[model samples]
Target: MLVRIITGIIGITAAAFVIQTGGVVFAGFTLLLMLLAWFEYVRAFSERGMGIALVTGFIALAAMWYAAWQKPELLALACPLIVLVMLLESVLMRGSTSIMDALASGAGLIYIGFPFTCLLQLRGMLPETVFSTEISSFTFGCAFVWIMFIGTWASDTFAYFTGTAIGRHKLCPSISPNKTIEGFMGSVIGTTAVVAGLGYYLNLPLQEMAVLGLLIAIFATLGDLVESVAKRYVGIKDSGNIIPGHGGVWDRFDSVLFTAPLVFYFVQFVNLLGK
Candidate 1:
């Protein structure tokens, strides 16, 4: 437990430092994560003898990064191409006559592609007005990402401790045996306090902060649950044993996978509403 905590803190600190520098540092880190995650996903499915899955996965990851960086406007042009490639690959894969396998490949692309794209979009959308004045974009982006990470980490931390301490009734025994309603509520409350406090300290509007906190708390829980369900379906305990204490890349990113898109759309929605 101590090792995990120390490693997590160190990992986060290094990530923050890289994000603070932005430009190549930020892009390189993001690309590395995207590739690693893609490889992991491909490896998982390849065990089922699904050829070309790795190729499709890497292509999707690259497409997302490119879309995020150079040609978001090209998404209209790119989505069809990706679908076509996947469809053709599915046909070429031996024994892909099963509709399920084809669907799984398509689902993997969407699942991995969308959130990966959102990370780039979030970085792209860093408010120039906020960053240009007094604060650097890198600093602001790091701070924003840090706030989101804090919410996720706090919720996970509180839920684990609280669940172990006062968990009497199961929340979803079929999906996650250890989870309890009490733990869920504890996580919500713990994360909300931290998120709201951070917003207040940052001088953000109270109502907006509260709303954002609520959204993060709710969505983050859902994200964790979603990953739990996936793992259950796949008959795995941890995604991978990448970190000493933490699970795999998927385990570390499960919550962020869902939260990234939510954060991106929320920011966009807020900006549009304000305008």
Candidate 2:
């Protein structure tokens, strides 16, 4: 508990600073997290003798990142190429690497990398991106980011307390035994409440922000569960031990992975509808 509290404080503080920055710097922060998460991801498999191509994995990430930064259109092209490269590497060295290894490695480069890219796109880092009309306003990006992070935080905090107090049934005993149905309820309701409360002040539509919060809570839970399942498959307790209590960047920021994309698309769709 002590370790968790300490880590939470430091993490929240750092995240606040980065999100507040809201530009290429914030994108860099997101990229750093993705890179760390990706490294831990591939390392987990490699340790299990998966023989993942580490150099190629990083090169793929770099290429994809460059595309997102320099040529957003090339992003689509880079993604499939990443998977193809990994598969080809495995095929050429079948004795060392397996087809499954290539698939997993390739997916990681996208799964971990793409969300961060979404975050970048969400923050309007790329040209002619996000908030269709408010091109120069970081408010559009920062406010949405606030929605995702705060909603996810509310979900985790409320779920922990709510679960401990009244949780009776396991939510997903197979993947994450500690999760409870009561906790899920708390997360969704609590996150929605918090987001609706703040969203109004942020100039977002209250009804829509409430819905976004609910969706964030749901997707955040799914993200955490997915990461848990991945770790279980890798036969590891946590992705890595970068955090004293939390585990790795993935274990810490897993909730944001899905929610970032969720918020980006939700906002864009909302904007389109408003038009």
Candidate 3:
């Protein structure tokens, strides 16, 4: 418990510092994380001796990184290529393998790569009309991203303590035995509180903050379940033991993987509605 709290504090602090720096620092850090995540993901599938899985994983990562940085145009081009490659590979390996391998690889790419890239894109999507000042725009963009992280983390922490203390009903025993309905409610409440506080500080609309909080809570829970399902399928307790208490990079960012894109889209939608 102590290890987890310490790790969580350190991770949040470091992430906030890097995010506040913005520009190359944030981009480079995010890219490096995505690459490492892709590596771990491919390594997991490769253990089952699926060579094509690794290839497709890297291809997906590369496409995502490129799309995040340079050309959103290429994503359309990349998606069909990924689909074709996966289909062809599945056909060629039909006699030798199960379709689960291909599905796992594809799922990881969409699960991890898509949101990671979307976050990068979010950083780039600041409105030129809002500010002539680059620093102000970057700071505003980073603030939105930071709020998402803070709310998600608060929700997870609340769920953990509440579930441990008072959990009686299993939320999804088949997927994650430890998760409970009490925990889910705790998470929602915690997330809502944090969202309300941050939204007031940032002057975001009350309704938007309420909705964002709910979405973050829902997506974060789903993300945790998705990772749990993956680990259960692979017969592993944790993705890796890199962090002393957190299990792995994926373990630490599981919620972020799912919530980031959702938050990004919410911001975009709000911006559009405002105009």
| Top TM-score prediction, candidate number | 2
- In model 3, the clashing pairs are none
Lowest summed-lDDT stretch of 10 residues in model 2? 126-135
Q: 208, model 2: CA deviation in Å?
A: 1.3
**Regions more than 4 Å wrong, model 3:** 1-6, 46-52, 91-99, 127-138, 271-275
lDDT of 1 by residue, 47-104 (tens): 5655436666677778767877778887656666776667776567646534556666
Cα RMSDs, all models: 2.9, 3.6, 3.2
- lDDT assessment of candidate 1: 0.71
Tens-place lDDT digits, model 3, residues 34-140: 77777777666565575436655776787777876788878767765676666666678877545766666666677777888878877766634332233344345
Error of 3 at 136 (Å): 10
Clashes of 3: 0
Q: Which candidate is the best by lDDT?
A: 2
TM-score of 2: 0.90
